[model samples]
Target: MRKQTFFLLSLGFLSFTSCIQEEAPNAECDIVTCRVINLENYSIFYSRHDAVKEVASTDSVVTFPVRNGADVSAIALELDITPGATVTPASGSVQDFSQDGVLYKVVSEDRHWSRTYRVRFVPMMVLPTEYKFEYYELDPNSQKYYNWYGMNEEETRIDFWATGNSGFRLSRSSALPDEYPTVPVEDGVSGSAVKLETRSTGAFGNMVNMRIAAGNLFIGTFDTQNALKDAMKATCFGLPFSQKPLRFSGDYKFVPGKDFQDRSGTVISGRVDQPDLYAVFYRNTDDEGNDVMLHGDDVLTNPNIVALARLESPLTTTEWQHFDIEFDYRGTVDAGRLRNFGYNLAVVFTSSIEGASFCGAVGSTLWVDEVKVTCE
Candidate 1:
């Protein structure tokens, strides 16, 4: 499952006593941790730990993955919130999560701030084979950017795709949704497809040495907290996958921007922008048994990578083009580890191949649709 779990850190006995002597509540409203209780009753989950999810600071939606037929209509949830904060619908209360989702509101201790979060239980019975880019809407929190979501074969909504648009929002907060780096296009090869473009990050970006933002989408999470300071780490890549991938195919239309630029936003003569599309399969643990995830810097060249599939040549075309690449295995697969969720898979697409280095040509665009992964 792509859903990340958490480890509840133990608080010191001294801290517990200090909480009882609190005189005032701080002005912070956040869900620090969340876990589903009574896991024994839910036989669908692999383990008690698998049902827990650590809420990200920038995330508004919390999701847990369970078997497709699992009943979550009356499950109990426990939430650890900020000091002196209060949560609506109450913690440790039974709620229905079989449909859309349950919305919970958290108010700061001083009532100066509030945040609404939607918690969901996602069914994970089958892997998604085809991506049609069908469902998308404006970012619910900001309403200033676009978000793309996919559906599984069972017609259940899936949130396996993540984008750098959230990071772009920091640079171009006043820009309209359509003007952002990534957006949804109504006139696609099929229904609605995703359009990625390399965009200029105004004066603030240049001041921070981040002159451009590239449009990118991948099968992983984006940590908005470290976006500006450490972009390579911000793009956490890959998701747990049990299947062995054979081929990756997709359709795309690309038009490169002229006069490619460097990290300092300086134009390079005779240079042209190039788009990137690739997938990686790798082990998800280090030698010491600690969880490991690839980032933008190591996704392509990581030593733990078992197989990779990448476009061999730069694709530059105005008309839609189809591409099918075969996975090239570099290491043997461990069947037992793969079955135990010990491996991860990453599929990535970017409007500018060098975008990770803050180098790319603004106005370069790439339209993609009908992507699929053929597995063994």
Candidate 2:
């Protein structure tokens, strides 16, 4: 089976870390980063900084958001890949991206592993205001898990949504898409809704002291490799935003699993699972001019946060419920910075409030749909 890698290119800046060089050929085939050389010459981008992309370790697609009227034909990309690997349609080579998605292949130096990447370019960012959970599909390569995305008014697929499903794959390769923590269900307020369930990670998870995988969906990216070293940091949160958000509204149904457990999988006598839904707006850069992102640990408490809107209490009901929360401003927003994409917005949904700590009941479930973010 071929290894999989995912890449997301946006109008914001990101600096991807490179892997250390190994002495000998290894079985790793990955695309660490992607960029266009001296992108200033390309007037098609909203910003020259938009040309570079930070790659992640799961999924099989690469997407770039370009300004309207940008010519993708003969567009060239320079990829920074694993030391001993080689990519086809070679790096720094021009490829026609004017039509259907193009496929790029990468073979490891050891020739033991490979990955095929699907690349596509979409026109300008359409600030996502509503999410109905109507667009989703199975992972292209494995067909083992589902990937959810939002569609814009132009009918273009938006890649802003990210999930922990990829991280869950690390423990359950044989698990079916439905058996995975996050899935789509037919019984929705409308057509289809997302269902997040806390699931047992079985032996593999227990071995690593991570017994349960929480179902999560958020506006950001996931790094599987980083999760192994530091789970909290693995869930990079927020995306560049150009507006001041006012409120977050959504519909949902929830059921807390019977037995609450800790990271060691030991059930706590009286503890109960709780669902979490919140939206955060914050500065995307630090005082030192370095790009910044909140993780599972500090997303809510980060000093950079400008405003936050979260449910005050847990909601548990079999029937659908509605909630609308207003953003509580903690700081001021600079109009100049807002126009320059200096801030970010993150909206997160999880079946278990403490899922990031691997503490949740395996059967806790939350169904959600009709999400809307109101802005000024």
Listed in order, each prediction's TM-score against the native is: 0.82, 0.84
lDDT of each residue in 235-268, candidate 2, tens digit only: 9999888899999998999999999999877899
lDDT of 1 by residue, 1-376 (tens): 2232222223454566667654666788999788898556657664344567878898888877675678888877899999899999999999998887799999999999999999988754344767788888788878888787777666776677889998888888888999988888987888888999999999878878999998998888999988888999999898878889999998999999876899987899888898999989999887776677899899999899999999877578878899999999999999987776678888899999999989999989999988988999
lDDT (CA) per prediction: 0.85, 0.86
Pairs with steric clashes in candidate 1: none
Q: Candidate 2: deviation at residue 82, Å?
A: 2.4
Best by TM-score: 2
C-alpha positional error of residue 199 in candidate 2 after TM-score superposition, expressed in Å: 1.0
RMSD (Å) of each candidate, 1 decimal? 11.5, 12.0
| Model 1: worst 10 consecutive residues (lDDT sum) | 1-10
